[model samples]
Target: MDKLEAKNRIAELVQLLNKYGHEYYVLDQPSVPDAEYDQKMQELQRLEAKFPALVSTASPTQRVGGEPLDKFQKVEHHVPMLSLGNAFNEADLRAFDRRVTQLAAEPVVYICELKIDGLAIALTYENGTFVRGSTRGDGRVGEDITSNLRTIRSIPLTIQEKRSIEVRGEAFMPHHSFLALNKGREEKGEMVFANPRNAAAGSLRQLDPKVAASRNLDIFLFGYGKWEADSLPSHSERLKYLAALGFKINPEWKRCTTIDEVIEYVSYWSTERPNLSYEIDGIVIKVDDLQQQEKLGFTAKNPRWAIAYKFPATEAVTKLRTIELSVGRTGVVTPTAILDPVQIAGSTVQRASLHNEDLIKEMDIRIGDTVVLKKAGDIIPKVVRVIEEKRTGDEVEFSMPKQCPSCNSELAHLEDEVALRCLNPNCPAQLKEGLIHFVSRDAMNIDGLGEKVIEQLFQAKLIKTIADLYRLKKEELLKLDRMGEKSVQNILNAIEASKSNSLEKLLFGLGIRHIGAKAAQTLAAHFHTMDELCEATYEDFIAIDEIGEKMADSIVQFFSEEKVIELLQHLSTMDVNMTYLGPTQSQMTAIFSNQTIVLTGKMESFTRSEAKKLVEANGGSVTSSVSKNTDIVIAGEAAGSKYKKAQELNIPIWDEQKFKEAIES
Candidate 1:
């Protein structure tokens, strides 16, 4: 076909294919067979390849996916994706309804929807063409996963309505997809995902869109961030309009005129949820009237007009066969109950966390006793309680191990802490866990060095410490099982790349007793270099607002360790970065310099972390709570107790926009 003919034909094919895909994937009703859709898509692909100039980014053929991305870019949301407060029972729902009614001063109609247990995402369309898609990282800023999202057939590349809009939705893996994915992983000898939610999240976060497409991810658009169209009066009407605009709206949603009706809907779905192909943890009820929703506003973290009624966790009774102990990177020994295989919340439960020795003692848990098994938040398996009535005289009481399971080192319980810890710096279990932490995503982030690879290397005696990872040669790596030329090169490159990471990453990777990622960042920003941090006195650390006495003591103790100092020196010799590279305390001493600032509520432009970072970068110190000494309080939507407290203290308050302008200035 000629250029003009190809353009018209491509447009026609795109519309037809998108419609068919929507019908099949979203509505679960296919008008055309797979072969018919495939033929049309193939024709479109052939024409697009012949006439490359005619191809558009939003073309249906592009849904097959593109080249892998190096990393996801950050995208600032135009509107904050506020999280919903949860209602556990009928009373909570009633209370939520009462609050909405009281605030609106009218009888409020509610829109109840199945809260899809999946990753929340925001999609922005420019003139009906999908422009960008992002993960709701922290409400305001998110990672741009546009390429990955495009692979989802339910998410239309172009909407029927020719208008700029931003819609929010849950991207999920169906039950079949999750099962298939886990089966595939099991076959490959890879760790299986715990649940569909985790599977969906992992698939979406993949660097390659092809990987995401293979996972068979789907989405249901529920709400709009920005709608540049004719105004809708109610949320129920908006849902209808969204469907009309070729968006996938969840069919399970209902409109309730009264609180009792809402309660009925919730109760009906609580049992019916398991029948659906997709997973849903709860029911999300929102005020039907948009005007009422607007008036009701939001709280610090969630919307006041809506609340999620979470279904009570699924439970099963099983015999506790034995107790297993494992040591974490922090050297804390944790007990896990090995149970007789039982199913709970759609997954088999063979083991559950006993948390610590105290939990076992408090619950009077014993091996050979019947125990109630339940998923904490329908994710992690936990032992709820012991069936005391079923307990026999032959049951064995479990005790905490006196020595480290891996290294046989004496374990000591720290003062004021419930967990008994192995104090041995050279503990093999601690070293292995520490190495795993060092290469983790938020730490040094050596991409190809997964848990399996780390274990393999440790077992083979190839790597004994974090610094030894850099010393891995391609020849030696190739000798290991499953380590091909390409894999070795990728791992080597990742290791080399990790050497340039900021000091905070290295600090966090060290697995200090109480130092977390955020704390590491704070310390890195404060000290600027590893040497400076090592030289910093306990008094200097405690002087910082966020650093507590425990953290300060830990930092001092960690730096004082001769072995740790040697390790730092060895890493330094290998050209590993030791300096802070991120935005630090500015020397300019701007308006916010030395000012105690507290950020509360949800900001449209900046997430809480971003706001805190910004405040600190401008020489300001951010505090968690409102205090008498607080100089300023930046309050956003639904600023609750913090705002009220700020008002009481007569402290100056700034809105999100105001804070933005100040930071910009």
Candidate 2:
């Protein structure tokens, strides 16, 4: 066929195949037989290969496209993927309803949906074509997994919606797919995933789109984010319209006019959950009206407009095989119960935290006893109670060990603290655990330096301190068992990259007593630099609203140590960033402070999210459209309606150059 004819054929085939796929995957109906679909797909592949330029990202053949990615890029969410609050029982649901009613000063409608037990993702489309997809990482930032997401049949490459849009959804592995994956992994002598949720999450994180496709991942669009001219009055209509746009909307969602109906929906799902094909751990209840949702607004963490009624943790009786202990970064030794493998809440319950000796004594938990095991919050495994009736006379009581498991150091039970800790500063386990925490996702986020690599490094005596990580040489790393040249290069690059992370990461990575992530953030924002923080007194810390006496004292103590001061200096010489990368106290009220800005058209240097972050960090807010209230419009090349609206409204307009200069100034 000629190129022109092939192009027309490709377009025709693309539309036809997409229609068939939507019917088969999303609607659970097939317009054509398998043979016919296969025939048309084969024809499309041949035509595309003949006219290579005709092969497009949206082509049916490109679902599992290209080579595996070396690494995933970070994407900041335009609209933060805020989490919903929880309602455990009938009273909690009623309380939520009362709050909504009180705020609206009228009866409010609500939409209830099954909270799919899977990973949350946001998909962005421009001109009705899918462009990017990402995980809901820390609400504001996420890993870009657009290639993996494209492999999911339920997600359309193109939609009927002509305008740009962002949609949030749950990506999940169906029960059958989960079973098949586990069976395949077991056959291959690989570690099988514990549950479908874990399986889904792992699959999406794969560097290869083919691997993600093999897992048969699916998604259900839950809601839209930052859409232009969103005039839909209610959430239910929005869902229906999204479904009409060839998106997969879960059929289980319901619109309720009263709280009683919402309660009924939750109650029915509680029992009927077992009958569903996929896993759903809870029912999500959201205010139906868009106006009501806006009126309710949000908390610092979660949206006040929605609540999740989490399902009760499933219980299983299993014999406690043994007890094991592990040391954390702070030297706190934790005891875990190893039990006979038994299924609970869709995952195998083989281990649970016994907490400390006090809990063990209070509950009288013993090995060789048939104990009742339940996952805490349906996530962490925990021993709820002892099945005393099922316990035999031969059951042995568990005792806390006196010596550290890794270093064989004497353990100390700190005053007023329940956890037995290894107070020895030089304990190997503490150092090893500290190294792991330092590179963890929420800390420095050195992606390749996982627990196994840290342990390997510790065992080899090649690294000892957090500073030693920055000192790692490629030649030495290549000496390790699994470290190939490429792997070692990536690790070194990641380590070097982490040196420039914002101050909050390093503060949290330090593992200071009584200072958790939030406190670390507070300290970072207040101190602005490590030098400033090092000189802070307990009084200085206590002056902050959230910093309690204990946390303040811990912060003061941590920075006062000569060893820590030396380490910071050493890291600084290695070119690590010491100053705060976020908004400083002085810059908080800069030129853009308290202004509402709108972005339009194509950006040359930074992405829309990147620009938004810049504006927000310096105390400006980014809104969707230009209006009389809009303080400035950051117009880029091919600036569209928003730019025109800014001119019409007599709002200030700035090119990217001016916006950059003003922010920098």
* RMSD value for candidate 1: 5.4
Candidate 1 lDDT over 406-493, as tens digits, reads 8899999889889999988788888899999999987898999998999999999999998899899999999998889998999999
Error of 2 at 518 (Å): 10
Give each prediction's root-mean-square deviation over alpha carbons. 5.4, 10.3
In candidate 2, what residue range of length 10 has the lowest lDDT sum?
636-645
RMSD of 2: 10.3
Which number leads on lDDT?
A: 1
Worst 10 residues of 1 by lDDT: 582-591
Deviation from native of the Cα of residue 249 in model 2, angstroms: 2.6
lDDT of each: 0.87, 0.86
Query: Residue 23 in model 1: shift from native, Å?
Result: 3.3
Candidate 2: lDDT over CA atoms? 0.86
